[model samples]
Target: MTTPSQDRPTPQDRPTPQDRLTPDELRTLFLFEALSPEQLDWLAERGRVERREAGEVVYREGEPATCFFILLSGALSLNRVLHGDDVEVTRTDQRGVYSGATRAYLGDRVEQLYPHTLRAVSDAEFFVLPADEFAYAVRTWFPMALHLLEGLFFGTRAANAIVNERERLLALASLSAGLTHELNNPAAAALRATAGLRGRVTGMRHKLAMIADGRLDGAGLHRLVALQDDAVQRAATGVSMTAMETADAEDTVSDWLDERGLAGAWDLAPSLVAAGIGVSWLADAARTVGAEHFEAAVRWITYTIDTELMMGEIDDSVERISELVGAARQYSQLDRTPLQIVDVHDLLDATLTMLQARIPDGVRVVREYDRDLPSIPAYGAELNQVWTNLIVNALDAMPDGGTLTLRTWREDDRLMVEIADTGVGIAKDVRPRIFEPFFTTKQVGEGTGLGLDISYRIVVNKHHGDLRVTSRPGDTRFQVCLPIEQTAEATETAESGETTEAGGAAEASEDG
Candidate 1:
């Protein structure tokens, strides 16, 4: 049934109708069949008879609801624009069917805009009544029904607002938890490295004093300095040796130290070997520092290596923390404007990074991104949420670990992002209802089930895009296709930084 409009157009001179139906004629229609003769007379007096030829425009969506229309003859089709195309929603030839000001009893509560375009498929005649008059008639003649309709309308709106906010909070909470887990490891490592570094620097002072004071002549001191520099240089080079190779090198270095009568130096073997050091380098250190000072020199050099490794650890940890912070910022888009041109790849990558902690070791993520895809105008944060939802669902599908693939490409005038997973596919019996709100196969409390529904509203209703999915036993793919160029209305909205709805994910849309 078409919902009616409650428009409040100010009183003004209205054109007189060339034809008007009598109360007896109006009584023939079902909507008037139950009305009293006086009520039918009121409608007949206020309504005009209008006609349209086949294939003529009846009214367009988004136009002001100035009048209420009741079908008298012929047929008309209703359509809504989706994904930049006019999609037929319904067609009717029923005599009592109505459109336009069907919601007139809602008077001024909403913008009195037509929700769908109506076009005559055959010669059509309509009984039209002014929007204000239609609303007056409904409120005056059906006072009880009007109040009930208002209750249903406002109650549903209130429920949707509550659900929308709840969905937003739940998604934010999940992502925040994952982000916190990801940040903690590097932060802890950096703290630990800092503590160890302080003690290493103090110990190095004492070790250097032992070697630097009266233990050696000037030339021998210079030789020890050269060996120290060499050790530091070797430590700067990352050891690219395999596990077996590293073990063999450590054994050889340990034996060489033992053979040289440096029996207590085994503890330094792993660190020196890890620094790309081996027997040849140790032999050079011995000859350079001389036998008298060799042990002290080795000890001091070991301290240098210790401090260097600790500093490297600190640097790595800090860089990791910085990376996570950057990813978090990108994922949230908190520091950036909400609406802007953004690359989908950056959005996808940031989402993956934020959710990295939640991803299982068995589930490997593969990004098959089209770097050539142009950046498009979008609400970056909301789009990130969309990516987050799709990725999380994909991960959950794989309980025992599977591949999660994110692929993006261009198809005609749209850009498509596909999140595919290899897991137990959705059952055909339950797939159709997946996108419905509060519908989930998961146990209660595990899912709010608004994900896909919200996603549909964001992409289709908000962004004028489309989402599709294909599933099988081992592989299921959800594809989100968005217009490469925005519609005029969308562009204006973006330019004005206005927002309507957000991302959601539940099930594949009907476009599939």
Candidate 2:
């Protein structure tokens, strides 16, 4: 009986298969599959044919590779031993080729290390080709090589697309979280006040039913009716009370104010008294109305209080809406032409106004303007966008909040605007890429990274100006410069037009 090793043909003893094909067949195969007769002959001479029994390991993990193998028959499995788990990478069967041909392009690269284990799922045959020979075949076989590379390229691109989509999803999640946090405060306050208003209205309805039942006499009924009237009027006008109603509202408001320990309640009392309200009106109304009617009056008073608070909140909501609209307008530079005569000071002031809410509580802005500076012909909207972006960025940098200085002056007939911040300055490495599109140091979702890029385009390209930054740790300054006068060519054209008109008039006089 022959041993397994003895039964297998050694490379030196194998018959060369290259001699089986004619030159014409070799040429055709070379064009289609990169296999030449001479190379085939060499492979046939040196290559070994190996048979793997079912459940046999063709090559163990971490073993040195002497040659690459291609599946000739049956199925072969490739696996990675990762963290004690055998992870299958791929499987190949008849008509499916494997070998260094698949990894020839990645030769010796760290990512292409060695001995990814191969196993046979059933009885199989493999034609083992040397790495060098396989690489040579791939280089010469354009069609075969192109086919393999196309699959690899597409696989890499698909992986990159998945990674990008995951990143975008994470970014959107962060933005949602921020918006939710911002909206919660006002939404919660509105809900709570609405519930309280409901409770107050319910109490007022109970008091009205008591009066309708005839439990109170004419004087009591009159007093209760008067209280309701005054409450309705106060709720409508937002003025606390009229002289007669003041006496009634004062007792309620004073008690409410005192309970809350609010300052300026006394200051408002004089105004209420002057408006014709006195203590007698409230005391007499309470006496005639009785405790039940008095309780009803209190409910109405509470309703008025709640309504005023709700109205104030509504006013605040409106203001917030206005701010958002203003910011959007400033950001979009709406209604402004691409090129127009613009006052840089006015543009800066408008941007500052729009960004007023973003400014830190204690931070003050100081502006030094050159009053005589000429109006520049520029894209007003674009310049406004630049100002808004830079100012907002400066505010963001100053979390602890410091003064911002805005300065404008003329430098040799060119207008220069400098916005300087007393905030933590940009780092050395970060400064270089600050103007690059989509490059930002802000925490993700806090910025879009296009602000400085858009600003740069506006100042440098649209307006034919220069934007530069100078910074060190706690101080950063952005300086923008724009030409005050038109280009020389434009100036020359104007002068030529004037000269032509003069010459035409002179010729006309001579002819006359």
Candidate 3:
């Protein structure tokens, strides 16, 4: 046995290529303890012992996975590049712990890049075997196990992709139905207001002809046209009033019109009041056209005011339609790139707008956003889905009516978006399993149970973020924390859902 230096080794002291591990030394490692003598001999011949200094990288992630490694001594760390940071997943000094080229058996079927970066936390020694040789040995010696692993691996990939797509479709269908219902109301209102507007215009034209007849002079007509401009301005900037206040104003206008002996005074009072027309304006009309034609002049002014109000209604209806369409586009991210810098508040607002029709009238929605928080790099569309799921869950939690709050803030190197609800919270026993696929408290057919699960994957696996939940009766909050920027390889496995998890040990079984 040779004693290695405690300090970093010099060139003269480094292990030579001729220094190889014998079958007996290879068998000392637990990984090869159960191998037959001939198998150990084969490994002893092909595998080499390599030494690395503290902080030295064995292999960087995304590089060609050329060798399989089994630690023989010293501590090592397994890290994956996530959101522009090297996030350490596992650190251990345990001998026989192996990593790198673990999937070489798949060969050309999959990209054979190192899944993680391995670094020596302390001076380390590893038994290394070329990827091709390791693949051959595994295929020849453990064909059955390898076959089972391949089946499970490929099966999960297919299932996750299909189920993920299905989940999105279900959400899309629901949003589409809700958006259609919301659009129909304003569209119908605009249509009705448009028809009424046409009639009002024709009436105004007939009234104009009567007022302009030999009974009235150009000066009177000019005064009425000038007053029409003021009416339009007042109608455009009309102030909203409580029901009682509005009724009182209408009564006052009605009394003034009745005192003047005008017919349909009650009918015209509301429109006149809404247009800010009062007894003073009516008195002016009486002076300008005299008592006999005063009724015609007042009716003409009423017609003008009514047309302005109708036009205001049509303008509001069109604006409502435009707002709904904009919200739908934001929620769908239909024209935006899949991954981009996104404002969490904008996404929240879009989601709320899309689900507005489904929200109970008794429930109140509140936004507590940190306007100073910067945008984050993410899969915008998938993140929108996450917001939708959390929002839907919050709404469902409060069937009896409560507050749904969306809050955002910056937390250290990450940005957090919190969705909180005042409702019957998740039970202690059920909380742990909420993110498990197909696990749900909702009744059968009411939920797919994949809502939270998919959300977790989107926030965690794709964006390299953290998702947590805290709950108690009347207060349940789901918070998602994401990095502000993404590394070049941040989304390498985003589409595949094959990202690694941070954990304690590598486990005994390779597939585990």
Relative to the true structure, how large is the alpha-carbon lDDT of every model? 0.78, 0.59, 0.81
Task: Compute the lDDT of residue 455 as modeled in candidate 3.
Answer: 88
Over 402-449, each residue of candidate 2 has an lDDT whose tens digit, in order, gives 989999999886789999999999899999779765578889877766
Model 3 scores a TM of 0.79
Show where candidate 1 strays beyond 4 Å.
1-33, 48-50, 70-75, 91-97, 122-127, 429-432, 491-512
Write candidate 1's Cα lDDT for 1-512 as tens digits.
12223343434544354578888899898778877776776666668898999988878877987888888999888777777888786787877687775666787776676767778889999988888888887787777878877877677567766876798898888878888887788788889988987887887788667545776878887887888787888898867988898888888888888887885767878878867777777778877877877777777787788778878988998898898888888888898886678899998998899889889999988989999999998878888878887788888899899999999999899999999999998899878777666678889888888787777667766678877778998999999989988776764432111112111111112221
- Most accurate candidate by TM-score: 1
RMSD for each of the candidates:
5.4, 25.0, 6.7
lDDT of 2 at 311: 58
Rank by TM-score, descending? 1, 3, 2
What does candidate 3's lDDT look like per residue over 321-399, in tens digits? 9999999888888899888888888888888888988899989998899999988777877888999999999999999
Model 1: how far residue 247 lies from native, Å? 2.4
Error of 2 at 463 (Å): 1.3
